[model samples]
Every structure is written in C-alpha cells, then in structure tokens.
Target: MRQEFDEEFEQFVRRWSPALLRVAFLLTSDRGEAEDLLQTALLKTSRHWSRLADRDAAYAYVRRILVTTHTSWRRRRRVHEVLLDQLPEHQAGQPREVEAGRALRALEELPPRMRAVVVLRCYEGLTEAETAEALGCSVGSVKSQASRGLARVRVLLDQSHADTAIPEGAR
Candidate 1:
C-alpha cells in the first residue's frame, strides 16, 4: 500500500509541478519565493500523502496550503514589493514576446489574491467554481475578483497601447 501510494504521489508531483510552480510564481511575484512556496507545499503534501484517500484530492490540498502559506507570507512582508518594470526581458519571438511580456508585467501589478484569481482563471483555465474551490473562497468571490483583476489588467494594457500609439500629427 505504501509503495503504491508512493508511486502515485510521485506521478502526481511530476504531472502537477509545472502548473503549481506557475501559480506560485504569480502569487509570490518572485522566482525564489515561488520556488520556496512550491517546496514547502510539496513537503506538506508528501507528509499527508498516505492519508489522502482520493489521490485526485491531493492537488486541492496542496492549493489550500499554497493560499494559506501565501497569506501568512504577505502579512510578514506587507510592504516589500518589486515593480514589474524591474523584470528583465527573456521572451522568445520579438513581436509576440514583447506583447506577452507587457501582459505579464500588467499581471504582476495585481494584489496577491487578485493575481491568484486571474492566474487560475486566465492562465490555468479554471472555471469560477473550480477557482473558488482551489482558493477556498465563494464562487461569487472568484467572479468578483476575476472581474476586478481583469479590469485592472485591461486598464494597464490600454495604457501601454496608448503609450505606443503613433501620433496622428506624426503619421
């Protein structure tokens, strides 16, 4: 039984790590912090792996740990923040990369909860109910947070677009 659990746990970790890391990165807005968050969550998940009956529920448990952990971290470092402008460009294609990079920058500006809501909904493609479950919040909260987060993102994107627009006089 232990061996079977170990195998399944290993498989689950491999399958979910990338997605988990992406969510953690968005929540923490720092590569090092994201790695730490993932490590801490995985460690917590491993300790409880044997008790998890439905193996599928492991992701939900891990996500709960992530939200709780992030909340605690936020309280500790309440004011320390990094602006997205400081992030270096490492995009692939010149045009698409630039566009996506701007989008990412805009995402980085949202508050942690709002950012998590957006990442789960937009990036992970989770529905409102699923996102609410993952975040341990009401579906209405997910809807509201997503709507507000998206509005902020659109404003930022619009500002960026306006900045790059060629003046009519110049054209």
Candidate 2:
C-alpha cells in the first residue's frame, strides 16, 4: 500500500508541480521560497495520498495546505520577531526587475489571508465561487477579501511609484 501510494504521489507531483509551483511563486514572490512552499505542500499531501479521492481533489487540498502553512509560518515569525537578533537581507535585483519587485513587495505586505485570496482569484484565474471553495469560505467573503486585497495592492503600487519619483523642483 505504501509503495502504491508513493507511485501515485510521484505521478501527481510530476503532473501538477509546474502549475502548483507557479501558484506558490505568486503566493511567495520569491523563487526559493516558492519552491520551498510547493515542496512543503507536496510533502504534506503525500502523507494522505492514498486517502485523496482524485487528482483534482488532491490539488485543491494541497493548495489549501500551502496557504495555511504560509499563514502559520508568518504567525510564527511574528511571535519570535522580537527575540531574534537580526534578519538577513538579500541584494537588490536588476533595474529591469524593479517594477516587478515593487509589486511583489506590495503583495507581501498584505495580510496572509488577503494575499491568498488575491493569488487564488487574480493570479490563478479562479472564479469567486471557486476561490471561496478553495479557501473554504463563503462567496461573499471571497468577494470582500478580493476587493480589499486589490485595493490595497493598488495603493501600495501607487505609493511605491510616488516614492521613486523625483519632485519637479528637484528634477
């Protein structure tokens, strides 16, 4: 039974990993973190592989796991933040990456649930109903979250551009 489950899990990973990784990347906004998120989701999913009703069910289940895991990780970090001596920072990306980077940073600033809702709806092209199902919430909640998330993202992007712009007198 374990061998059978392993084979099924491997096949599922091979088939769905690319799409899952793309979703994870949107959720994480970093290549390394995205890969790690997907791996963690897959690892969790594999434990219940034999019990999953079907491939689509497994995919949806794993997506939920990924979102919840990310939220948990964020909460853990917040809890330990004051105790930590320092956090490592990475070097800046290329000039061409600036706009994308700003958008991602803005997304990162959103609350975890809002970020997940935005990624599922906008990035994944899921309908409100579909998103509600994925997030295990009502359609109304999905609508509200998506609206607020998009609004926050717009404000963040505008602020980012404003910060980078030179004043007319200084130009």
Candidate 3:
C-alpha cells in the first residue's frame, strides 16, 4: 500500500510539475526562490498523501502549503533590500516583458496576505469562496482583500505609467 501510494505520488508530480512550478514562480517572482518554495511545499504535502481528502485535489493542497509557507518566510525576512533597474536574466527582452515586470514589481509591494488573495483570486481565477477556502479565511475577507488588493495594484500601475510615460511630444 505504501509503495503504491509512492508511485501514485510520483506520477502526480510528473503530471503537475510544470503547472505548479509556474504558479510558484508567479507567487515568488524569483525563479530560485520559487523552486525552493515549491519543493518545500511538495515535501510537506507528500508526507500526508494518504490522509488527503481527495487525490485529485493535490494542486490545491500544495498551493495552500505554498501560500502559507511563503507568508511565514516573508514574516521572517528583513525589510531592507536593493532594487535593480534590469529584469532577471530569464525574463529579459521578451514581448511585453517590460509591462509584465512592472506589474509584478507592483504586486510585490503588497502585504503577503493581500498578495496571496490577489494571486489566488485574480491570477488563479478562483472565486471568492474558493479563495477563502484556500486561505482558510471567511468569504467576506476574500472579497475585501480582492477589492483592496486591486485598488493598490491600480495605484501602483498608474504611478508606474506616469513615471514611464513620454512627455507630450517626446514619443
């Protein structure tokens, strides 16, 4: 029975690795950090494989671990950090890369909880109740977080636009 579960778990990882890794990357922004985060979450989730309610819901289970783990890491991390003018090597020079980078940078400014709410709701296309379940919060909290998170993102994006805009005839 244990060996069968292990084989099933391995198959699950092989099937979902790409999608889960992408979500991890989206959540963390740094590729290396994302990989580490996902690996940790997967390790934690696998320990309770037989106890999971549904084997098909492994991604959701793993995502909850990822979000909570990330939140914990953020709390432990220091506030001070340097900013860079350039994109990470993996993302540079791609189509729409500049705009996407700006948006991601703005997203990073949000508090950890708010960022998770926004990513789960908006990025993952989860509904309010679904997001609430994922975060272990009330549905009302999910709604408010989504609203507040969007407002903050809007402000940040607007500011970035103004900062990068060409003057009247400069274009």
Candidate 4:
C-alpha cells in the first residue's frame, strides 16, 4: 500500500510540476525564485505525503507551503535591501505588456498573503473555497484579501495613470 501511494505521488508530482511552477512564477514574479519556491514546496509535500489524508489536497498543501515560503523570503529581504530596478523589457506594439508590468508592480507591493490570495483567485482562477484551502485560511479572510489586493492594484494603476502623460484616452 505504501509503495503504491509513493508511485501515485510521484506521478502526481510529475503531472503537476508545470502547473505548480506557473503558480509559483505568478506568486514571485521571478523565474529563479519561482523555481526555488516550487522545489521547496514539492520537497515538503513529499515529506508529508504518507500523512496526507486526501491525495487530492496535495496541490493545496503544496501551495500553502509556497505562500508561506515566499512570505518568509520577502520578510527576510525587507530587513536588508536597497532599491533596485529590475523591470522586464516591453515589446513594441505590446501595450498589454506595459499594463501587465504595472499590475506586477502592484502585486509586488501587496503583503504576501494578499498577493497569494490575489494570484490564486485571479491568476489561477481558483474559487474562494479553493483559495482558502490553498492558503490555509478562512473563506472570509480570502475574500478580504482578494478585495484589498484588488483595491491596492487599482490604486497603483491609477497612480501610474496620473504620473504618466500617455494622453487621456490612450489606455
């Protein structure tokens, strides 16, 4: 039985690795950090595989690790960091990339939990209940985080609009 479960777990990890990496990328906005975060999450998940009651909950469990891991990483960086500009280059004729960059900046400004909630709910298209499960938080908290995250993003975008002179009707 244990061996069977192990095989199943391996298969699950293989199948979900791409999706998990994508989720991690959305959370961190850095490819290297995303890969590291996903690896750490998967390692932790593997350690607890046998104890996990519902196999289907593996994704949520791994995601929770990602959220917490990212939060810790960000917290540590806050204590010792200087300002730096590392924005990605936008392609010509790709207005969407510019908008995405603005949104990404807003996401980076959000608190870690709020960022995870927003990414899971909006980017990953997870339902509130699923997000709550993945975040290991109450649905109410997820709702609040989602609301606040979206509000903050909007504020950031609005500020960008005011700061830039891209014409009134361009966007």
Candidate 5:
C-alpha cells in the first residue's frame, strides 16, 4: 500500500509539474523563484496526497496550494535587491517578442493577488469560479480583480509603448 501510494504520487508529479511550474513562474516573474515555489507546493501536496479523495482533482488541489503558498511567502518576505554581476543584454527581436516582454513587465507591476487572479483567469484559462477557488476568494472578488488587473496591465503596456515610441517623422 505504501509503495502504491508512492508510485501514484510520483506519477502525479511527473505529469503535472510542467503545468504547475508555469503557474509558479507566472506568479513569480523569476525562474529560480518559480522553481522554489513549485517545489514547496509539491512538498505540501505530498503530505496530503493520501487523503485526497479524488485523484482527478489533484491538479486543482496542487494549484490552490501553489497560490496560497506564494501569497504567504510574499507577505512574509522583505524587499531586497539582488546585485547582478553584469547587465543583461538587450536583444533586437520581432514585434511579437517585444510585445510579450512588455506584457510580462506589466504583469510584474501588479499586486500579488491581482496578478494571481489575472494569470489564473487569463493565462491559465481557468474560469472565474476556479480562479476564486485557487485564490481562496469569492467569485465576485475574482471578477473585480480580473477586471482591475487587466485594466492596469493595459495601462502599463500603453505607457511602455509611449515611452518607446519614436516622434513623428523621426524615423
């Protein structure tokens, strides 16, 4: 029975880790932090695996864990600056790449709960109810957060565009 439980848990991790990692990365704009966040969520999930009644709902269960854990971590951590060894090189890329970078930066500007709501609803394509469940909030809260978060992202993106735009006839 113990071996069976371990096997099932291992398989669950293997199958779901990539998707969960993407959620973690979206919540945390840093890859390293995303990995750590996912690891921590998975550790918690493992402890509760045997008690999960529905195996198929495990993904949603883990996602809820990820969201709550990230929220808690953000609340407890103090802001600190990391000094990089060298400046990052800017690459000249296609328009889509530029737009995506702007979008990600805009996402990083949002508050954590708002960001989580937007990511879960927009990026992950979860329904409002599902997003609310993952976020431990009411559906009405999810709706409001999604609305405000999207509006803020749009404003941020527009501001970035204005900052980078060339003057008329400057080309």
Candidate 6:
C-alpha cells in the first residue's frame, strides 16, 4: 500500500510538473526560484497525499498550495536580490522576447497577492472564482485585484514602450 501510494504520487508529479512549473515561473519571474517554489509545493502536497480523497482534484489542491506558499514567502521577505557586476546584453530584433521581458517587469511591480491574482486569472485562464479559491481570498477580492493589476500592467507596458520608442523623423 505504501509503495502504491508512492508510485501514484510520483506519476502525478511527472505528469503535472511542467504545467505547475509554468505557474511557478509566472509567479516568481525567475526560473530558479520557480523551480524551488514548485519543489516546495510538491513536497507539501506529498505530505498530505493520504488525506486527498479525490485524485481528480489534486491539481487544484496543489495549485492552491503553490499560491499560498508564494504569498507567505513574499510576506516574510524570503526572496533576495542578487547584485551583479554588470548587466547582461539584450539580443536585438526579437520583438516577442522584448515584449515578454517588459511584461515580466510589469508583473514584478505588482504586490504579491495582486500579481498571483493576475497571473492565475489572465495567464492561466482561470475564472474569478477559481482564482479566488487558489489565492484563498473572496471572489470579490479577486475581481478587484485582477482589474487593478491589469490596469497597472498596461500602464507599465505603455511606459516601457514609450521609453524604447525611437523619436519621430530621427531614424
């Protein structure tokens, strides 16, 4: 029975890790931190495996754990900034990459809970109720946060675009 439980959990991890990692990456905006976050979530989930009566709902359960854990970490200021001697050079001519970088930077500006709400609602395509459940918040809170977060992101992106735009007739 113990071996069966272990195998089941392992298979679930193998199947869902990629998707979960993507969520973590969006939440953290750093690949290394995302991996760490997902690992921690998985560990927590495994510990509660026996209590999970519905295997079909495991993904939702784990996702809720991920969001709560991330918000808690942010509250505790567990994330650290590493200073580098020099900035890395950006490759030119990749419009998508530039846009994605801008979007990520915009996300970084949001408060942790708001950022989680936006990522789960927009990027993950979760409905307001689903996002609220994941964040352990009321649906009304999710709605307000999503609205404000998206507006802030748009403002940030527009500012980024303006800063990078070439002057008219100056090319």
Question: Whose lDDT is higher: candidate 4's or candidate 5's?
Answer: 5
- In model 4, how large is the Cα lDDT of residue 33? 86
Number of clashes found in candidate 3 = 0
The alpha-carbon deviation from the true structure for residue 114 of candidate 6, after best TM-score superposition, in angstroms, is 0.5
lDDT tens digits, residue span 73-111, model 2:
777766421255777564666656788789888998888
TM-score of 4: 0.80
**True-structure Cα RMSD, model 2:** 3.7
Q: After superposing candidate 3 on the true structure, give the runs of residues whose Cα lies further than 4 Å from its correct spot.
A: 80-95
lDDT for each candidate structure: 0.85, 0.86, 0.88, 0.86, 0.91, 0.92
Q: What is the descending lDDT order?
A: 6, 5, 3, 4, 2, 1
- Writing each residue's lDDT as its tens digit, candidate 3 over 1-171 gives 989989999998899878778777777788888999989998998889889879888889998899999999988985736699986676546748888888899888888899999999888899999899999999999999889999999999999999978899987
Off by over 4 Å in 2: 1-3, 79-96, 169-171
Clashes of each: 0, 0, 0, 0, 0, 0
Strongest candidate by TM-score? 6
Top lDDT hit: 6
Q: Per-residue lDDT of 15-78 in model 4, one digit per residue for the tens?
A: 8899889889888888888999999998888888889999887877787888889888888877
The deviation in Å at residue 93 for candidate 1 is: 5.7
- Model 4 steric clash total: 0
Q: Which ten residues in a row have the lowest lDDT in candidate 5?
A: 73-82
What lDDT is reached at residue 80 by model 4? 32
How accurate locally is residue 5 in candidate 6, as Cα lDDT from 0 to 100?
95
Writing each residue's lDDT as its tens digit, candidate 5 over 119-147 gives 99998899998888888789999999999
What clash pairs does model 5 have? Answer: none
Residue-level lDDT of model 6, residues 55-160, one tens digit each, is 9989988888888888888888855687999998989899999999999999999999999999999888999988888787899999999999999999999999
Better of 5 and 6 by lDDT: 6
Off by over 4 Å in 4: 1-6, 79-90, 167-171
